[model samples]
Target: MVTFAIGTDDFVVAGALPAISRDLAVSEGTTGQLVTVFSLAYAFSAPVMAVLTSRVPPRRLLGLGLTLFAALNFATALATSFEILLVLRIVTAVVAGTLSPAAFAIAGQRAEPGYAGRAIGVVAAGLTVSLAVGVPIGTWLSTRWGWHATFVAVGVFTVGALVTVAATLPRFEPVSEAGIGDRLRALRSPAILACAVTTTIGACAGLMPYIYVAPISEALTARPELLTVFIATIGVAGALGAAVGGHIADGWGPDRGMIATFGTALVVVLVWVGLHATVAPVPPVVIMGSLAVWGVAAWSNNAPMNARTLALAGPVGTEAMALNTSGLYVGMACGSAIGGLVLDRFGVTGTLLAAIGIGVCGVAAMVISVRRWPTGRPARGKAGKKARV
Candidate 1:
């Protein structure tokens, strides 16, 4: 529930950019910084928080983080200037940064043996759900009421999530063995580094087109109302992909799952680009279908990749997942920034092609990781066998 609320808060901004810009008297480009700054701050701060809070009880940290998240969102609802909103976003990012790694670590720690990937996937799926359901609802509400109403809605959701957590969540012992140095050392592992590279590239590919999806939809459909449908399709596909990815990772292993998903995404993007470039009077169904396919392939890699990070880091899975989270946000920041730049210099086709190229690099990295290191989980053929341990 906490994740669901935070995820909504993070993604709902994308759909509300026009309303926010009109209200605040800022360019839509400036409003885009809200996504970039929040991502950058969260990326850089998460690892530090993971190490600092390693010894704090999970329930305490989780509660405090959720409280801060709600408060900051409420504050965001009241902001009168763009600058104020940006600053508040940064603070909210830091608080959000604290919550995710802890939640993932808890999921990792508590999952049944051989089912860790499934647990992590459920948690991660919250973001995709926000993308699919929350963002659209928020966008519609913003259009009807105001962007302020959207933020208030997120705050309200968080309050409900907080109550649920307080009532149902179990207490967890501190990860006293984890330390800053231990966390840093995990990054030096070749497999871990490869996973991070894959994360960056895959995320870049997925988000680059996403940052400008509204305009892309407008170009394709020429009907502004259809933008909601496109957004909803992407979200729904992504949500399904995330859920399926977890089950696959639990069975076949995270590394192989990433390889498959990234490879598939690359193919889907190539087809999308070709159809988009060549098909004059392109059918709306074709464009929407491609977007949905791309969404599934791109998003399905998330949980498996995180599960792989945990497998690689062993005892420091919490710290490793923190690093993984950082990599994701960094990619998001870069993708959004670069997408904006590409939009300015070359236009939408250039942005799409750039993402396709990045997707190829991500696939190559995952390939190398699989060949060079033994992935900790079983292969698809060997899945469901009893553990040797």
Candidate 2:
């Protein structure tokens, strides 16, 4: 629930962007900056926070993070200006950054020997569901009551998440009592840095089309109603993909699993782009199916790759998890920003081609990591860190 609440808080903005722009006397582009700001804060702060409070108990940090997240959403509900809202969004993002890493780290530590993947998948699935349920619901509430009310609802959900987390999450001892300098040392590993790069690039490839989804739908086909359906399907596909990826990762080993996911996703993007010309003016079902396939492959890359990254950090598992999560958002922000620019300069097809190129680079990076570190062999244990499906 805490994980889903984190996802919900982030996704709520997508549905409310238009209203937020209008209410704050800002342009829609500026409204999008809200996402940019939050992503930036999340990316930079995630690992750093873990590194800073390396000695802090996971349960305490989780509780504080949840409370801060809910309060920030509450504050966002009361904002009267874009500046205020943007600042408060940053604050909320700081809390949001820890939610996923902590959840995954805890899940990894608690799962039975053979069930780590399933456990991590369950937590990640919550975030994916946020896109399906939270985004649309927030959009609905904003349309009906107002943007402020939408935020209030998210805040209320956070309250529930806080309660559940406090009750259910285990209070585990810190794995590393190292100070900031010590935790930061984990990034010094060349292999570790390579993992971050590939993960970021892969995420970039996946998100490129999403940032300008509206324009892409407009350019590819005449009927605009397919747009909403496509987005909704991607959200659902992503949730299922996350859940399934965990299972896949546990079986195939992390490196191989990521290779399959990233490689297939790259091909799918190219296939989708190639199909677009033929898909134009088609039945909605075909387009929906294509979008769903794209979501499934693209989103599936995270778990196996993430699990591999954490393994490199040794005892400082939280720090590594934080780094990967942060990189994920940073890549999303960069991809979305660049996609917007590419869309303006070259239109939808150009964006697709550019995204494919990024994916190719991601594939190359992952392959290079495999050769350098070869962390695909699973260790025999139910404790410490584990990879995705």
Candidate 3:
């Protein structure tokens, strides 16, 4: 639920950009910076905050982070100017950065011996489900009641998440006993570094075309309403894929899971590009089918990535998870920027083609990483002394 709320808050603003621009008397381009700044802020802050708050208990930190998140959303809804809203978005993003990694760490730590992948999958699915469920609902509420209402709704959802987490989550001390220097040193491991690189590249590839999905959809279909259907389809498929990916990670090992999912994603993107380039007037069913596969392939990679990071990082898994989260947001920001540039230089076809190239690079990176660390086992140095699993 906390993941769901934070995901909703991250995505809901895109849907409300136009309304926000009109209300705040700013250009749509200017209003869009809110989304950009949030992503950048979250990307940069996650690892830093994780280290700074290393001594804080997970449950206490989660409660405090969610509380601040809720308050920020409410304050955002009340802000009168674009400047204030932008700052609020940045601050809210920092709070969210603090919450998400802790949530993942808790989920990973609490699970039984072999089931950590599935447990992490369940939590990661919240973000995908938000795309399917929360964003659409928030978008509708904003459309009807004004953009401010969307923030209010997210705030209310956050409160619910806060209460649920506080009641159900166990109180646990920090997972890693490493000093700040040791925590930073964990990033030096080959497997951890590879996992981080693959995560960043995979996220970049997955989100590049998605950020400009509207344009791609418009080019492929005449019906405007199908846009909503397409987004919802990806979200739903992504949620299912996340679960399946986690199960695969548990059964097949995280390395194979990453390889298979990323390889599948490469094919899916290639097919999408082919469909756009060769077929004139692509069938709606074909488009939907392609999107469903793309979503599954794209989102399924997340679980294995998380599992692999946790497996490799050992005692500092939480800090590694924080870095992974940062990579995701950074990739997202880069994807958006790169996608926009490609869209401007070339048409929608070019954008789809660019996604294919990016997906290929991501797959190669995963393959290289897995080959280097065949078993996806924990490291053997000082990092392994207090390994969680």
Candidate 2's residue-wise lDDT over 183-257, tens digit each? 788767777778788878887887767655655665666665445565677789889888877877778877888
The TM-score values for the models, in the order shown, are 0.92, 0.89, 0.89
For 27-128, candidate 3 gives per-residue lDDT tens digits of: 544555576678789989999998899899987898888999999999989988888888999999999999999888878876666677878898889888
- Predict model 1's lDDT versus the native: 0.79
Model 1 lDDT tens row, 147-168: 9988988888888888888998
- List residue ranges in candidate 3 displaced over 4 A: 17-34, 79-83, 377-389
Worst 10 residues of 1 by lDDT: 380-389
TM-score of 1: 0.92
TM-score of 2: 0.89
TM-score winner between candidates 1 and 2: 1
lDDT of each: 0.79, 0.75, 0.80
Question: Clashes per prediction?
Answer: 0, 5, 0
What local lDDT score does residue 173 receive in model 1, on the 0 to 100 scale?
90
Deviation (Å) of 331 in candidate 3: 0.7
